[model samples]
Target: MIQRFKASLAITLAIILSFTAVFAGPKDTYASTVAVEAKSAILVDAETGKVLFEKEADLTLPPASMTKMMTEYLVLEAIDEGKISWDTTTQISQYAFDISANPEYSGVGLKLNKDYTVRELYEAMAVNSDNATTIALAELLAGTEGEFVKMMNEKAKEMGLPDYEFVNSSGLNNSHLDGNHPEGTEPDATNLLSARSAALLAYHLINDYPESLEFSGQTTAEIDGQKVTNWNWMIPNMPGSLSQFGYEGVDGLKTGYTDLAGNCFTGTAERSGQRFIAVVMKADSRPSRFRQTAKLFDYGFQQFQRKELFEEGYQIDGESELPVTKGKEDVVELETNDSLSTLVKKGDEENYTIKYNISKDKLDANGKLVAPVEKGQKVGTAELVYSGEDQYDNILSKKTNTVDLVTTSSVEKANWFMLMIGGIGEFFSDIFSGAVDMVKSWF
Candidate 1:
């Protein structure tokens, strides 16, 4: 009989092990995959701002036309704040006409002294990387391009662009560094951005103004009776373009290039309800930036998952029950007040830990929950924290995500008779436990 009992115990242990294996979190290395051939790059989950991958992310480099993203953001913000109207016309200056308004330069064909609406100029600058169009908006918004660059810098400070610097709204720094501008507003001398900072700006812009995608994603637009195609080659197939470097779910962002900056792109792609932002800077070629960004997107979509870590009205621990004193029932169910959510990368879930902390104030002197409990009463909290580090050893978020714990249902006070019965049951349970201890001590 003893041997049979031992055999049964072994089977029970094996079953428990299987159950643990089934429910245990997966073990994974929280790290980026192969590197892209960009001088600096970073890929981040837009919703969570979690960096999935990065290379030289904080190294400052020229942002080229990407600076216009900030310009667009400011203009849009002004329009939203009622400071500027879409129909408001801005006049082109000799500077705007001299810099870009011809076949040699990419622009929406703004002639010197010609008036263009704010909406049309936005299209020209955002879609075609029109330097003149961006400068026109700058002059309108801040009286001069130099002053607009100053506003851009101040906005950058407010937005937490750690290593981002603006020299001009158009990002035409290389050519305009020596051009005439206000003494204090020359962004041309300081137009530099780290991959991480630039990606952050992209995140802010996309989240704040998702409508900007409608303009940036356009493959072609007409300006001054002439059709102009966006310089970005990742906008899928157009009528005349034979490029197949397009990616699905890639909506809008911005691309940049210059002799000193090489090729760069701040790309945002959404797949399966998950959006990822990738910034590739100083790539060897224009197509290389798009290809590198696509690589990051592919990895992001495949390697990470958006998971509801904790659910409302569910016990954080698989089995959690609290004994209630002088209540209609002997026990009550506990649940989380809110669901804690996160984008967990594959192979790194096991490292994510959830800790439950029950409130001591909720219990009586005997360590049992008292009667007359109300549902949804805040009893405690559960902290969900991720322990993954980026390549730079930077903890993605130093703060822990938490959810509140609460009672699932009310516990009315039990009648005197029922309370006496519960007390007797508890007394018997303690007696039985003591007896078992005595038996074990005999062994």
Candidate 2:
């Protein structure tokens, strides 16, 4: 009998293990398949800013030349706002000329007394990551790099970048500037950004100024009869060197490196009608950043697809109707104001659930909405809740997975006479119930 009992226990254990394996399969599938070898990394959908995967993405570190993306943004913004134009011209300062002449740095020679158009300087700054050209543009726009650094900081705050600091427009270690660091920052400070923050900046950059891609995507460009190649080796159809690292569908973005920051890249690629943005910080080498990014892109494109989880006007099962106080109707029907969609691992839609959050202010002390509610009035919100083992939120700090909950039809207030009659009936009914309870206690 004891031997038979052991056999039964073994069979039961096998059954339990099989159930666990079946349920846990999807969550473990894609995440374990891809790994990024970087100090910090993030992958997000370009259109929705939905984060797919992240590893220590909030850890802040020097971004090196990636900081130029912000400078590029402000330059384009200035042109768009009529403060500057593509044809607007500025001359190089002695300071800019000194930086440009350094062979150790990435630069194109700038003639100090020669005027350069915004288009020329911008191309150099964006394509070659030219430090002097960046400083020249900043000085032109803000009167000094010091004032431009202030604008950079203010703009970073406005865009809700969570972890960032700007010490110079050129993204050089301030120490490299030879005692000319921006006034508001530390003398030795370097521009810093988290991997997530870098990705967010790239998201805003391409979405706002898509034309920036025309410059960033170029494998080669010329300024002053000298051709400069983009440092991003992963750019499609790269010229002459490192073409093996070229990734298809890749276009404009940015790359950076420093003794302090290591190799970093914010890359964007579109394939199969979907676009993804990825960032890697403190990578081991130039090629490693691109390799790590390719792994993320492969996982994103292969394993995930955008799915509409709930349709517009979708109503919850038991929560479809909310009670209404002093209304012609006893309850009001509630439905989602907009459709909800999100990127999910393929075949994992069942892992998502809806949570309805009714606004307390919209209801009275009795937990019921008061009468005179109008159709389509927002009463609360329905938030998407992921029940999967691997869960992630959008890069945005604000609500991204939530939609407004609204009433399906108007609820008119009951007439005074009807309210009075109902109150009288309730008063008598309560008295009768109290008498019955009192009698039951005596029995």
Candidate 3:
């Protein structure tokens, strides 16, 4: 009877453990990873720069034609800085002309010694992934493709890309440059960027020059009477093969391919007022990149949402007011200056706390705000501190999970008589406290 009783207890414990594992929720299956078919991949919220998912995101690999993203950024910057305009024209060099004339490379035919406007070349490079046109724009802006490569590296550093190397304006292997690779780069060198770096670059591009999408989103465009088609088949409403892989809200990004890089795509999509950027590098096939991107979008859209964790003017517990210095009021009511919203896993909204980050510049030596404070004046920021097991940093160099902290009402400086009275009270209070300490010591 004793042996039978012990066996029964063991069976009961095993059954309970099995049930617990079965009902732990679907999130348990993918809390730390998602199914992505690629060498390196990442998904990020466009507005917040918060990473939603990543897999081998820091592994450096060839970027292929995606290198033109930097070239495109530089051209747009030049145009915005008043150094060039869409109408500005430059004749192609021998190198550009030769590359354009080659059937092996992607290009629209360029006539030697003929002028091409910035608009024409930009459209060709953006929509068609034209290698020669990319070089032409680089030369036009930097006087040489080699110098433009320098600018690309500098800008990448400024943007805080975690890992990247830009050897040429176009992403072609140096051997493909027909023995005319950029002046400073080696013949074997090629452009390289990690999945995280590519996503970050795309984030900056989409946010900085949204106008570029006007071309990248195009299914097809005519340049000098030659038809050019966008290689990205994910664009909705695309012609012919669009029905096979068209994804809604996908528009305006870049694609890359080479023997070494395999297939890569930096894709962005929006739905129900939310936008996400996804990058897939070294995918096995041309279609695999788009399919992998679709999986990332499905995970993001189905499992997460932009939740308003804190409403506007919501006051934090124990931090509802701030001490005032030399003001009519001893304390000033405080609240969030604006709503704090961010992308979070659905149903996990209660797992965050507010961390007050009061700015020193707004305070006096006494760790209190000075008098004459205006209503709604920003004092510092309130950061949202997550208390969950799954936490990911934003792709940006700075954190985005914070909102401004502001004063609820204005406070005026106290009158001279009131100041004098307070000073007298504090001086006496200090003396009394010291006397009490002295008495205790003597005892």
Candidate 4:
């Protein structure tokens, strides 16, 4: 009997192992198949700004040249604000010349005595990944790289990237040098960023400088009659470089590397209809950075889809007609202030539905409003229902998108008061008519 009990236990163990194997297969596949070795990595949807995948994404590390993304962000902001124009010319300052001449730094090899337009510098900085051009642009914008670094840090904080810290606009080491002096002492400048922060910076640039892609997305350039090609390998090799990933809907961002950072990349890709940002830091090597990013893009485009929740000016629902007080029109229409859209799983389109509810007590006896309804007013709430099993059904079901119901302009408070007075007048008129008819019948 003891031997039989042992055999039964063995069979039960085998069954449990089989079940675990079935469930663990997909998890193991993801772990084993991803070859890139990075301390941190993240893939996010550009449209919805949703994180699709993450691995130690928040751990801060040396960002190398990826710090240039913030530099680029400020440059574009300047352009947008008209502080600088594309044709604006910037001279090569002594500092800019020094960075370019320094063999230890990445530079565009700009002639010390020459001047380049803001457009040229932007292209070189973005496309060739020129550290020197980036520094020069910063100095030109803020008068000094130190001040610019301060601006960069401030911008990071404003954007809520708390883990990011900028010591130099060029992202060079500075600790080896005297704290007050940036010159000499190997400049010891290093840029700091995390996978999550890098992605966020890219997101902000793409959002703020939609025009940045016109430069970063270029695979090649001819500045000052010399040809330069973009260092972002994925732009050339990706299947839809210009047609699909071009920064028009996309924007020019930056990539980074160091022996310690190990080939980091923060990239943005946008088709007019869709946009996505992918960040991989400390990737095992140059090739792996692109590979990991491609994986991110594939997962983003394949697994998720965007659904329109509601369109602006869309009529949500109408119960009984709302009363209008004292206006040319006696009713108001409710609508959403803005169109609503959400990223959903690819196959879940038909399963989603929207339900709207409005407060009935807010209306007058005539079914009109009491004259306080505004256009795109939040008069109703909408719930999105899905049919299939939900991974986050309980959490998601509790949240609903609100729809705006617009009120007619004629439905004003004054008009409503006048309407009430008119109603009273009509009531008195009916009473007087009945009394006169009674008196005539008696005669």
Candidate 5:
């Protein structure tokens, strides 16, 4: 009878565990399908910079006018720094006039010598995809297109945008113009860029210039009282158009096309307060570009979602307090260089844990820190760990999230020479006093 009861209890426990396992939500799966024409693509969370999906994303390919994205980025940077303002007016130069005349190659049709506000010009450049307006804005910002190109390249380097090169403010293909130039003609090569770099540029621009959406996302605008329409037809006509996709939060981005480069696009979409950037390059046709982009965006929104791992200004375990050798303060604090946050799935928090490992050392007596301390100092590391029976089932599963936690402030090192001299003087004084006391006692 006892054996039978024990067997029955075991059977019940096994059944309950099996039921719990079966009822748990489905594990994450990377469900993606790329059309044959797509040569390279990438999708990323604009907030966390997490790459959700990618195919040949780092492969270098001609970006066509998508090069204009960088031009747009620099222009916004100029505005933010107060170098120019929306109402500021600029004259149309001869170069700008030339570019506007070539309709096949130019996106703008501005009349030469006409003055337009910085605001109007930005709309013409971004909304209409105006090449002439892009050149004009670059010249106005840097005195010449060449100087502006230099600034663009410099900014690219600073941003770690490797594999990107800008020979002109507008990424017009320059191979046709090369060696055919008259004396003093600036070399024109269509701006060449990769899918990854283009996405990076889009990511940085939207992040840096949130206000730029008012222009790029605009389907129609009146500049100098003239109506202009945006070139990005996907915003208005695509099946999962920004409005239809419920990506009303979507804004500011650009598109590109050239016979050699095929159709290329870089766009951002936002929903429920989370923004994502998607890039598709070298599609077979204009329509296909939209289709491919839609698919990529769908895959991102459907397959993954962003979750906050930690709140900003939330303190994780810091380095153990270290004794200050001779300073007024007894201890120093350590923290992360920035706040800790990550993109996570809907119900994975229960399996995640944050772990901290800090160094054990005390500051010296002379208020000197040991050698090897660096600015934005990193003295320890923190990691996030996920554990469950089937944690590895998901493609985006993360076993741990690690970040460097560094010293929050600078540590002043003591002058060893001064300390040595002071110590020596004290020792000699003590010896002299002891000898004098001994002589006095003998007397």
Candidate 6:
């Protein structure tokens, strides 16, 4: 998988360039992990999806308001796809009005027959955790909230979420409300999302629809003449907020709480060019959720440093590069038009391996890439893994990143005579390569 990533690149190429390029050792569980009180928790590298730390990540649990992240995601997706404009007006259906008034749930007080723009409802749903507004948005987009939940579930499947079941667009279970359920809706409905899935959903939201942070991260907003505060306490100035906690980098994400699920927060922060997502589900208290998240971010930011493994559009500096067959040139300069980066500990790049994900069968026995290599054409990618004793490393010690290596100059099919000459050269080169490895082993 040629997953495009951005990190720091400080490791120098040590051997001949190949289809396989590795950075450091394979990473597993990171060390010195901070214990979180949540029932399920995961801290991941936002760019690389590396699970730096996790506890019962796949154990499914009620997501509560964190489920609203999905609700707002579909809304933003519609706005981006031009299906609905921010100004697109939607009516507050009788069902939405019932949920707001009868249950007296959190909302901007959406009333029956009142028309609110998509932007207003979205802000209410995301920032204020307004249940009525989210249901309204869901019904407007999918004809009914139930249908919209189906879409949400489908999206979760598409995103490879380990497990997710969205009960309502509002993330409200029947138990949370004291009043009657809307006529057609099931009172027992509730969303279930594991920490891994929550972090994954947050990843899609922050990366795909960055504009969402504008709403989720805000300390407060106003809709329909009502002042609303973003429930995410990580944001500064929120009610009884933990913004005083050291991490000002905590920008945007979601928070949730319910009778079934304790206080849960899926948090993200960027410091020193590194962005990390930490999800703590079912914590005993709201403040502790942020506190645990803060500890996770501290572990990530302090222990990990961003490294650029391969720079995008950066030319390979080596003059004696590898040969390419069936091309006009006997050899071609290789460089990456796309960059890749990873997060590694401060000083662990000393002996990393280049794990080439390339299909070596495409190369001649001499290990030369076959011809028709076009400029900017991706022949293969180089992944940074580990070598020597470092192969058994984990997240804190190794950072895995991959970058596409393309031809700096295009290579066309050579004449038949040249092909024979290249084949012979490859044969000898392979032997020499093996011999060189044998000699190096002796040393």
- Alpha-carbon RMSD to native, per candidate: 14.2, 10.8, 10.8, 12.7, 16.0, 11.1
Worst 10 residues of 2 by lDDT: 1-10
Task: Estimate TM-scores for all models.
Answer: 0.76, 0.87, 0.90, 0.68, 0.67, 0.75
Q: 3 or 6: which has the higher TM-score? A: 3
Q: To one decimal, what is the Cα RMSD in angstroms of model 4 from the true structure? A: 12.7
Which is the leading candidate under TM-score? 3
Indicate the TM-score of model 3.
Answer: 0.90
Q: For residues 271-310, what per-residue lDDT tens digits would candidate 6 score against the true structure?
A: 7667899999888897788888888888888877777665
lDDT of candidate 5 over 1-443, digit per residue (tens): 01223323433644564466455442222222434347777777786566666655555667887888888889889888998988899987776777777768644567876788888888888887877788788889988877787788788777666457676766666554334222223444445566677777887887788887778888777765677666666564433343343234446578888776778888887777777788888888877776777777766676566665654333555433444433334455655554455555556567766665664542355544464344457666666565743232111223235677666555565467855766788899999999999999998
Model 6: ten consecutive residues of lowest lDDT: 1-10
Q: What is the Å distance of residue 88 in model 6 from its true position? A: 1.7
**Tens digits of lDDT, candidate 4, 250-281:** 34457777665678888777664777788888
Taking the tens digit of each residue's C-alpha lDDT, what string does model 2 give over 152-224? 9889888888878788998789899988787877777778788889998998899999899888888888888
What's the lDDT for all of these models? 0.77, 0.86, 0.86, 0.67, 0.66, 0.72
lDDT score of residue 391 within candidate 6:
25
Tens digit of per-residue lDDT, candidate 3, span 311-379: 889897777788998899989988898888888897778897787888999999888998988999899
In model 2, residue pairs whose N, Cα or C atoms come closer than 3 Å (at least 3 residues apart or on different chains), thus clashing, are: none
> In candidate 5, how many Å is residue 57 off?
1.0
